[model samples]
Target chain A: MLTLQKPHRHVETVIHSEVLIDCRIENLYYGDFRAIRDCDLSIERGKITAFIGPSGCGKSTVLRCMNRMNDLVQGFRIDGQIHFQGQDIYHPSVDPVAVRRHIGMVFQQPNPFAMSIYKNVAFGLKLNRVKDDIPGRVEDALRRAGLWDEVKDKLKSSALALSGGQQQRLCIARAIATEPQVLLMDEPCSALDPIATRRIEELMLQLKERYTIVIVTHNLHQAQRIADKTAFMYVDTSNSSRTGFLVEYADTHRLFNHPQQEYTLQYLRGEFS
Target chain B: MPTPAQSPHVSQSNSMVSNHSKRSPARTSPTFEVSVVSPPSTTDVLVDRGFRGLAYVFAWLTIVLVCTILYEIGGHAFPAIQEYGLSFVTQSTWDANNAQFSVLPEIWGTLSSSLLALAIATFFGVFIAIFLTQDFLTPRVERVFTTIFELLAAIPSVVYGLWGIYIVIPTIRPIATWLHEHLGTIPFFSTPLSGPGLLPASLVLSIMILPTIAAVSRDAISAVPNQLREAAYGLGATRWQVIPGVVLRTASSGIFGAMVLGLGRALGETMALAMLIGNSNQVSLSLFSPANTLAALLANNFPEAGKVEEQALMFAALILLAITLGVNMIGTVIIDRTTRRLTGGTS
Candidate 1:
């Protein structure tokens, strides 16, 4: 039987090379409202993991926990462990800024800073104190994000002049400029058109070769098309208090075709989405 | 062709025309308009016209008041300006006994003192705004502190003058003396502090303008979008880095506006400066030397002046107004240019 049980400490350490992130969330709360119940998930290295759920299911909450972005919220508390490369990210000694330096995030809306495209990409490099070969690194990041060809001619022009799809690509380039290992994308294509969406999905597929990508999306077709593994989360209202929990997680084809849990089946069948 | 209502074809065409007019108001002629029953009553028309007339008058009051003030001041200042010609603003002599008055010394005093006040106010005000708006204090504590700072502006100018004389002068005397003894080679700090002078007056002016700068700056900093701060943090920027790199950059134009407002207040301030500044009609480089701004001179000698002296004071007032207006205009232009650049505008 293939059981998704918690691995022991030594066993996890032994299998650490296979997994890039291990999220074991016991409970998460915002103020007095419980947001997420006990959940355990493992993200494979160099693969795309998609978190798919309805609104208010706390899928983005779990994604934010991976990079400790939830720490910015007031009265946000978590009682769990998210281990990145065999180290607990929430440990007292871990600096959030240092953690963020290694993990980058792309937001739902393409928020290019109110500056030039080159400066947007160089912001992270400068913050990390990358003094030497900054121009080369910025060009390299833009090329990898598939934006260099479009923006190379106007590197000094304001980023606000770019089209919506180009701006999203610029944000992606900005995030990866510092060479972060993991990229968390929260609906990166939600604000994009169909063509832009396809382009970004293709870019993500190519990016997974070098970076571990975790994405939260409401579009199930997008997950089925690009994700290697898919995790389904549902609002668990069995105990009177509503909180989200992991329902089923498996390889993309199996999760969509043969969901094991009744909730997953209902969600897939458009009965209780 | 047809007996009006007897012919079916003629009646049908007439009905069609009525239906078309009903469907489209734009197709109806002005003389054939529908009156929708009763018109407005006589009392309503009267009241409407009356209200509009009042609003028009109120709107024109500002222009009328400003023109009146300019005319009166110009008329009084004409004699002095004609007598001195261009030398009225260039030469630095104010012998009222000989009816010789030049605005050079007062112009230097006003510019130097007001500029110094603005510099000091901007330095402390920006820091105070940063402290108040950031996460260093709780919201409740921040409100209390902000209210206290606002209260500083409510204190009258004469009260500030009294405080400067009794408390501030004695307190800063020792520090001024020490600075003069140590940094004496610097011309600004060379003179020894003996009594009320330019330094005390400027200190008092800075204090008076502090609340204006602080309040406006606090509002500007608070107006910065939280998303910019979050974006900076996501890029692994520390709090200190985010402040200068994001918050200050975004709020720079508004902060400049706040400083200009403080400068305006500093230039026009009268009672406190009249009492604190040793009203001597001379220009000196040392901060400890006695000086007189145009405002202080007018306040000191306006009541007991002869006809020519009065005209001279009026001329000084006109100069003060011109300088303040020029500063405001230049400051606004600079701020506008900076904002345009920040927003990626070509001009």
Candidate 2:
């Protein structure tokens, strides 16, 4: 049995080499409230995973934990392991800025900096020391997000001029322009109309073929449409403490059609009422 | 209504008289009211016409203010101009006994001291502003420093002059001595001090203007949007890059306006200059030498002036006014241009 464990360890090494994000947590806190309690999640390489939950269920919190964007908030902290690719992300040796370069994020609101559309996409590239041929790179990013045909001639126009759905796509294009291995989206389509939302959902499907995608969403239909794997979360109000728990995580079809837990069944049957 | 000017048909007196004196008082009154209600309506015209009258008065008052200032300065300086002509600007002679009052020395002294003060104030003031705005200090500490600087500004200029006389002059003497010994090799610091000179005056002026620049600059820098800072940091730029590229660039126009305003104040300072600058009459560019500004010279000699000399002093006052007005005008223009550019509009 000890010899059998040795070969399993080597196979595990091969499996981890293919993983893009490895998250381990003892607890995550936002001012003494444990948002995600002792949760461990690994985002697979080149696959789309959807985190589905009710409001305030720590889905977005876990997504922010991946990129360390939580560091920007006051009194937000996590105790545990979060490795990007293979390196310990929270270690003193790693700079948060450098970690963020490898792990890109798209926020719920489409925040393009107050500049020209082209400049907005090129902002990250300049900071990451890619100075040559910015126009070409910007066009390429826009094309990948399928926005180039609409905005190619008007590159110098203000980003605020774009529609909500187009702006969200622009944000996605901006994030991928830096060529990050992992992309984290927090309800990327919550503010978009159906057509724009459909476009983003399609874009996510295409993007996963090249990069790992982890999305936090409240819409179950959206998860069904785009996610390969699904994580269902619920707020645990049992101890008079506001916290969230991962109720179930499995292949999307099974989680939806053949859920095991009573709570999962009741939730999927819309029987929370 | 009656024909134009033919009013007897609807006149109340006519109706009352027609009713006759034998009628009862109530009956006559009703008849009179009915007659007046229908009378020709041509009596509602009254005019004070005061606005048109006041407009001329205000226009004349404005003209008078402008002309009086020009006349007072011109009338006093006319004789000096006649006697010394343009030589007053070119030559440095200031023999009060001989009555040869050329202004080259005083002009040079004023420009050098004021410029030096502006330079020193701008450096320290902007540094303090950036420090204050960037959260370098705690809120309580920031408030204390801000209050202290503002209080320094509110202290009367006369108090600053007195402080210069008793405290600052004596305290800085040793530093001045060291500078003279060490930096005397440099042409700027070559001259030796005799009691008080341009250096002491410039130091006092710097202290006076420092609060002005700092307060205004702090306001300007604080106006930069937090979004700009976040954008820079989000791109992996450090705190240093955010300040220079985002905060400072956004606030540049406002900061420039603040500095120019401080410059105008420095140029026009009076009491401190009168107190500390040795008031010598020479056009020496040397910082260590005694010198006089137009204001200081006017303060010093106006009381003792004869008719012609008084005129000369007024001309000097006029010159001082012109310099200040010019500086302020230029500052206003630059501020206008900067704000327009920042807001993305034509000024």
Candidate 3:
């Protein structure tokens, strides 16, 4: 196993001493195609870190790597280390299923199971074999997700009957029911209207008080609105084949207003994107 | 002076009429010309009518064929039905010399054997589908196994009968004897006959229908969307957890439909059961005792039956047809209800 020492360039002055996840992705490939190259970044504990880039820039790929969700894809292999807390998650002995239990994920589309709302929220708890007070824990999670009051009377109804926004919130409740330490969202609001988008943004902001968040989005303004730290990635077309690399990483306000790299500045201004 | 007055009056009249005609062009000669054109060509009209006639004829062909078969069978069996007056189905005696016939034993045999076959097929078929469709095997290997299963269905029924008589019965006789010795307290395994009987017949029928059930079940399992699987795995479900909870639940209706289709095939089987079931006329509790199904009875007796005896056989055929149709109707209703529930009643 490769253990990476904390790199010197990590921006520690903006945050306190707690660093929850430190990612150093040397390379990621699918079959023969390289997707991400030489990417390194750190996630601050209990804060929202956003990965902002254009489409096909490997932003979602990096986010999936955090919880080892990319292992589901055939022929997907990673070459470097991803350390969660102090332990190497990519080591041979670590089971991906157990890794996912501690780090939950919400996809771009709201995919509640083909079951009732109560079952959808309780699915994770049952999988982990929780022995007592399941209904209480489910209601607590639903309340935290801002969905309990709306769906309190009809928990037995099908989840598909809910509106798009409510379904997304239900998905959030399902993810948080297990009380994972880290939450990964890959464009969680890309499928919702603006009003629903704002609600989820507020929810994410509230969730940051308890869990570390890593989000991937093509909506630059959404990243600017909620992220504490932002990482900008762009496709590297200088080589024979295109691969994505991290261009700049900084506090969200600084990266948006006064970007350090020329590419990041151009991307912010929507110049030739 | 007279010519100038006349010319002014004529020019004024002509200008007034021309302005009126321009205001109403929609009702004038241009529209009239379009309306006066000829109707569609004779060949086009004839071809359209011909195609419609052909379609009507094809649609009625199935109805006509069914009515004819029913009419012929009813006409032949009318004497037997009138004479027996439902006793044909209630009594078990089938003496050919005195022309007294009954199908009670055959009815019992057909129902018990087919139901047992269906139960066994459904149990193993669902597991096979789940195994083949899951991530346990590579796609190439899965394809090979699927092809081998399909080949089982393609073999002729007579071949299965011959194999059952030669290999399956002899091999299973010992086990049947052991079952009689150990579990004989249960009526199902009570008697120990040394030859072909209901147990071997049902086992052969189950093997024959296995491929059909497995194929349909595999299709059902594969039809479940990837999103459902992903949702389950994303919530940290193990492979075992995801299968029965998510995949099987989603495919339950389809599996039920597959079992019904296999039952239909089993109920109609003739040569295979005739060869293995020992073709006896007794209704006993022991599966080791010899028995006769309705289809096997027809196949065995239809060859040299007398006039009244042939009518009895036709009556038996009619009963078989009615039962199969009833089973299919029930299956369709259940499948419809399940599909409607799954789709939230829109279907």
Candidate 4:
């Protein structure tokens, strides 16, 4: 709702795709510990952007910042600005709940409410007062998340009764039911097995057609397989305390094949600190 | 003169390894020693049997205690039951002068007073649970409130009775009169506040059980994992939407169990109700009128009762026991099922 007009847009960004989220982060800290710094990136609309890095590289931290999820953490502070739909999400006038309604997120673990599967998907619609046909919207959202058929017959049963992978998909369905502009996923497949992981990877690819997706993944191969653009971040250990910063951002093919930085190359080649 | 003691200690430390080898026979045995796993000795068998016998005796002592109480109460109640038959419970009059007694009014008093207390306690207890569990207040303030709840539970019932007689009666008498004046047409507020009555007793009972309901509801609410909160928030839910919509719904059964437990405590409260309920053997719909519960009736008359009065009082005690015990059993079952269901696992 608030306009941040000081910074100009990054020109020639990501295949010249329309910029959906313009982020300019100078520093991020939690109670005196710096997590990430100087990470500026633009998320293109209807595109799958992957962040691949090792542990503690702030890949998840950066992803959480997109939806303002980090605001829930104690003493979490950000010297940054993020604009979505040409409005600054962190402005005092802009409510975090309203920001989340526009930008949804799925965590690393599958967290379904104890309610029935139907209620889980319909929760957001009811909260946002989507006066449209609720049952129809729930079915459509589940269908888009690729969980409808498996759950259609037992829509009234508890969501916890579903398997691990199905519950994760239900979480995805719950997130997308509100029809958010962007879906931020923080290692959505980390807790799942390989089969479940592959099915979700396919689901992500399908979902990218409608929603702009930003995923932080430790799986290099998975990112290479699905992402259209990839940003690589590495832990900056030049000082006494190591913190994460962006090393390279480009098309997935260019970043994988001919990386711009030696850190990116070493990370791709399995060389880690 | 004592210098040789240090020299002896140094010699023992120097040869500690050799001492262990000589002292421990197990060190020389094979890795698997069959003798070490041999059958129990005679002393072990005797000790085991003696311990088992003592445990069995203690277990049977509890059963015997329960049976003794049941037999004594039933024996004394036989005279009243034989004379009055089923009419004893349905009849309205309790005339010890004519050797005629009934328990309907006492039953009404017990149920109405307990339920009224439960309703009031539940209202305040649930709000206390929500405000305490949610991260709205400073943790220091939350801790202070939690300590107050525990202190409320720790206070003696007799003290509550004294407070009810001296403080609660004088305080609520005016409010009861105002309601009776404006709402006299309604049966609940029909009568004027006669000295000690159902209204004051019920208020004191609510204060007594408020801690029970609040503590149980707090545990149930907190048991809900933060993951569910995250899930709800991630779906764009505001705090108000999330509290009743998600958190309360998830812990509903547990909170119900807590109310049931509070009802159990209210049903069996004797001293406080005895002091405040006026010990009148009459029933009326007006909460301002004096009434007597089975617990207070038994507590008040048992010391001065003659033969027939004693028999009737014993009957009252039996009914009180059945209601309170049954309520407690139901509460325990509900709490067990829901806590296991709510906290089974988190995704």
- The 10 consecutive residues of candidate 4 chain B with the worst lDDT sum are B1-10
Writing each residue's lDDT as its tens digit, candidate 4 over A1-273 gives 633221221222334498999988889999899988889999998799999987888999999888788877877999989888788888888878887887888989999988889988999888878776899989998998899999999898778888899999999999988778789998999999999999999999988867889998889899899898999987765545657888889999999999988777767876453
How would you encode candidate 3's per-residue C-alpha lDDT over B1-347 as one tens digit per residue?
A: 00111222346668889998778666555655565667899999999999999999999998999999999999998999998978988999889999999999999999889999999998889888988998778789999999998899999999999999999988998888899999999998989956889989999999999999999999999998887787788877888999998898778889888988999999999999999999999899898999999999999999989999999999999988887888889999988877665644533
Q: Which CAPRI quality tier does the interface of model 4 achieve? A: incorrect
Report the error of model 1 at residue B176, Å: 1.2
Kindly give the number of clashing pairs for every candidate.
Answer: 0, 4, 0, 0
Candidate 4 global lDDT: 0.86
Choose the strongest candidate by DockQ. Answer: 4
Interface RMSD of each: 19.2, 24.5, 23.7, 15.7
**Positional deviation of residue A134's Cα in model 2 after best superposition, in angstroms:** 6.2
**DockQ (CA atoms), all models:** 0.16, 0.04, 0.16, 0.20
Candidate 4 residue-wise lDDT, B279-313, digit = tens? 78787999999998998878877788889989988
Model 3's chain B TM-score? 0.84
After superposition, candidate 1 runs with Cα above 4 Å error: A1-17, A237-242, B1-60
Query: If both were scored by lDDT, which would come out higher, candidate 3 or candidate 4?
Result: 3
Which pairs clash inside model 4? none
Over the stretch B1-347, how does candidate 2's per-residue lDDT look in tens digits?
00123222236557778687657676546666664455443443223356667888999999999899889778767888788888888887777677877888777877788889989998899888998878777778889989998888998888899888888878877877788899998876778776788888999999999999999999999987764554455455556766775688678888888888888888888888899998888767667788889889988887888876777787778778888888788888988876664443522
Global lDDT of each candidate: 0.87, 0.78, 0.86, 0.86
